[model samples]
Target: MAWWKLHKRDKPGGPAAGGAVLASAAIITRDQVRSVVGRRQEWQAQGWDFYRTVPELKSGIRWAANGLSRARLYVGRIDPDGSSAPVPVDAQGGDMSPAMVANLLAPLEDLAGGQLGQSEMLRRLSVHLDIPGESYLVGFDDPASGERRWLVCSPSEVTSTGSGGTIRVQLPDSQSARIELSIDDCTLIRLWRPDDEYGYLPDSPLQGLQDPLRELQGLTAHVLATVDSRLKGAGIGLMSDDVTPASPQQSDGPNPIHSDPVTASLIDAASASLKNRDSAAALVPLLLRVPGSVEDKFKWFDFAAQLDEHLLPLRESATKRLAIGLDTPPEALTGMADVNHWTGWLVSDTGITMHIEPKLGLICDALTTQYFRAAWEALGIPDPENWACWYDTSDLKQRPNRAPEAAEAHARGAISDAAYLRELGFSSEDMPDEEEQRRRLLIQLATTNAQLAPAALEALGVQLPDVGQAIATDAVRAPVEISRAEPAIEAPPRNEPPALPIAASAVLDDGWRMACLDLAARRALARAGNWLLSRSGRSRRGELGHVPVHEVHMHVSPDQADLAQMLDGAYRDFHAATPGETDLHAAVDLYVRRLLLTGIAHERGLLAGHLAAAGCDRAAA
Candidate 1:
């Protein structure tokens, strides 16, 4: 499978940037932006160009890293336009990939190994918690007092899906069973109550209030392998139903974007204000490198897309308006043909509210004899034009008159209007010109069917003098009785196709693998003694680019002493912390400290230094 990754600056403006920020801050002497534009030709030299906006992440990515510096955030995952596949299960019901199965069964692992309370485990996982009449919220619980606390799900959880809510649990026997969490109010969020006795209570209050990052969101995922292993060990129903990977999609250079509503919203909305001050903060890197008409079009589409992305999501009523209009009249304004081009207009904006209106909006006219001219078809008559009388739609009436060709087709009738075309590179229209009609027909056919090469002259009624088949072909045998013996099989005795070496074979030696390994190691450290993740693997698991959290753990005693906590605490004090806001500057300080610590680990041979350059520890933390 093909994949891609990016090495972002630890912070926006760093030294290696070679004054990248300074160069980008303004149009400078050095052609930084210009160079990207020029490079467009070079890219065209390599592949076809298509206008595109960046896509959104299909799954919520959880990246965590550690070192002398704080970790940063970025998007990961392909499109989840639809959840088409399920976790795979092998015969005997166990998965061939044990590591994956182990990772998913995290909830069960904590229950079995960490020795945490059922309610506490549920809480730590940020899932629902219950112990008879008394109740507790996930994560919101006080560690010292054991009082109920507000809990949040991790970033990687799937908040909603088609088949109501989903839940999967693993018992001590290693078997995992899928269960549907009762969804009382989907508008809010819903989760399974740990106590079955209260599970069915609609008024239980927590019914529809599902936490975004609940560990249970991944609960069904974790025990998948265990379920398979258990089923296999016990001779359960055979399977692989739930385990296929999603197909990959289009990419651009090092960047790969999924095609989804979010991406469409972002890239399409880019047009409204390609140079807007707010978007400049995050878009400079991407925009400076791409240009041409796409940038222009992105602005208009961006306005409509943002309406659905940012504004629409929070205002519940908009969802209703959108659902109703998606397939009908109002949809034309936001539909592909209009939003994609400048064929639409922003009719109203109360400074707060914006209304988009389509040019050739929608078709609503009824056809009639009056809509056509007399002698509309005289066998070899010109195709009828001027269908204006037939349609009564305001959109069609208001459509901008452009594309001379589309307009040319408007009024030409039985009498060719050749007299009207001398200035348009054509002889007079209304002339009984056969060649002109054929050429026009050719263009019409090509536009209607982009495939199929232009029809040969002979095929056209115009008729070529003489031409034969373009290529030769041979017939093949067919029709065989099922009872007849199969064709005799023969084996090749010696000759075989020559082997070819991959274009690039040093990929494994490169630091990408190590970067991924370090990512996994840091995650393992974060969840140490936690159930989900399996026991440590061979040296392979802790290979290059890996700043294993295990290194820090080795220095800790029985207690889980996180170096990330220490660095976070130090930065938190240095920078002011609001009650709940994510401190941006503090994040920078933490990443810097993390880098130093990780760099030190590499020097001491306790961790791999090569991974430090790639920010593996930071990404996973």
Candidate 2:
């Protein structure tokens, strides 16, 4: 039954109402449907034109395309845990190297046997997908080599035949003919989905950006016109009081030259000369004058400033809107004026993460499902479904260097060796296995012991053994015998006078103790400040608040021992100045604690200043 008839039959009044409703229903003609589709196609064509002609839009698209093209492609296996791993090439469980994988997929490097390498192909695909909302790739086996070869087809030149998964592809043959191929041989990657009754075809990102793009184009044209007008000296306008020019007979006023035909002709010539100047005459001045009354007789007006006040802001606003629509940072399309190095890096990272990665993901998934899988099957690779093509975007991301932080964490035992190695950009395969790490550790211990053994034996006054005999003996037994035989002769002590007590000795000043404590405090403060700066530098603007203050205090904790040693030396020198019963060690410990508290407080203030400068407080709110 027709959809309209079914709708009518569901009415409240049964058959009679059904017949009436059917008669009153409005039918959409095939021409109307075609007209809608035609309009959509025309809109898509306009989008392509914008991508080609509009500088801002073109710049944004190319930025995304180039970023995606920088990614390295690979074929790997999908593990059971949803993570991907390198594909093993042999029964011995040896993974295929990148070069070997590239060799296997060498046919895809040049698509359709043309100069289109993988990078160029990916760039074109990204451009097409973003601009027209869809792209097509057709795969075929090379007749000569029986290896897979693919061609990137224009979306406009490919269409679904709506029968048995067949598609009509226009080939660039001598006749410029069209050919029909199964959908299995082609891949269609698209962006947005269709909501109307037209079909399942996806819509371009430009669909919602048409208004902004058109406005940007208009503003650009206006700017160009304004610039051209300025270059032609159109901003300068002349005004005069006379409504009509007087003839030579009426030349009785103070401005008699205005009535003189020769003078008027000379003035016109000078005006024309001043309009456009050649490069050679650009710096030369040409003056025009009329032999008339001064001041109010003639006036000049400049409109360049007025034009800028109205037009430039609109142009900038339109540009920002278009960039937002494209999911790209404005700094990427526009020049990076007023941007710092850190801000520039942030802009690049955001462009890749938010704008380029999604498009790359779509393209990769489509190729893997429709192109790489089939090729694998044709080559009789076992379990083809277990493997897929992927892209590595590590080269595109502007990740900050956190090696210092990683090292600190590793030393603190906060992270595993593997995690630390990964943070330093080492892949899992580049890291050593447990057994290898243990062997290396043992070798390092043995080398250190060997280097120190001679000095240690001399200090102990023990005779050294022959190297060969030592090696022949049991390693454990040799160490035990040497340790048991170690015994160093001691020298007799020289007699000296006993030190005086505090009250019985000459009075010493507090200046020495204060100086030592101050020096130690300054060193501690410097250490704390350096640590704070390093932490702030590594954190993002929003992450400043998340910096662990306690960790920083712990980092400075070692300086407390240095301060205690300084205090102890100062106490020894000044003990004679104090009372006999004074507990100097207790006093020293108290002063050290006070200095530590003050230093920590100073660091906290510095961190707060950094947080303020980064606007983290506002961000948190």
In terms of lDDT, which candidate is strongest?
A: 2
Instruction: Give stretches of model 2 more than 4 Å off.
Output: 1-40, 79-116, 140-149, 156-199, 233-308, 330-351, 381-383, 408-419, 426-447, 451-621
Per-model CA lDDT versus the true structure: 0.26, 0.52
Assess candidate 1 and give its TM-score to the true structure: 0.12
Over the stretch 1-621, how does candidate 1's per-residue lDDT look in tens digits? 100001111224457764432111111122221221112122221111110110000010000001001111111121245242222222114422564333323222222123224323222221111101111112212335644222222211212233333222122233342122222210111232223565433121122212211222233233453343322211111123332223234568675554663443344334323344344323322121123354343331111111124333433343233323221233322334435334443311110021111100110011112111111221111332321111111211223334375346646542234423432434333455788777777766533321221362334654322211121000000111111133111112224321212311222233553454444334434443221113334452344224345344322222112333333233333233322222222223233333333221212112233223223233222
For residue 98, give model 1's deviation from the true position in Å: 45
Q: Model 2 compared with the native: what TM-score?
A: 0.51
Q: What would the TM-scores of all predictions be?
A: 0.12, 0.51
- The number of the candidate with the highest TM-score is 2
lDDT of 2 by residue, 1-621 (tens): 311123223234646655332211111122222322212467778998888778888888888788877876666666668754444332114465655555346424434443335777778787877777666565544446756445566667666565655666676564577676543333333323243555456566787899999898887887777665444333322334433332234346776545455456434433443575443222322223344454655654443333667677788788888877785666776567777866666777877877787777777676666555544544445676777666777677766677999999999999988778767877657877887786666554433343333444444454544642243222212222221123111112224322222322222223454344334434444454344445454444245454443224323333432333232233343444443412222233232333343322322223222223322232112
Global lDDT for candidate 2? 0.52
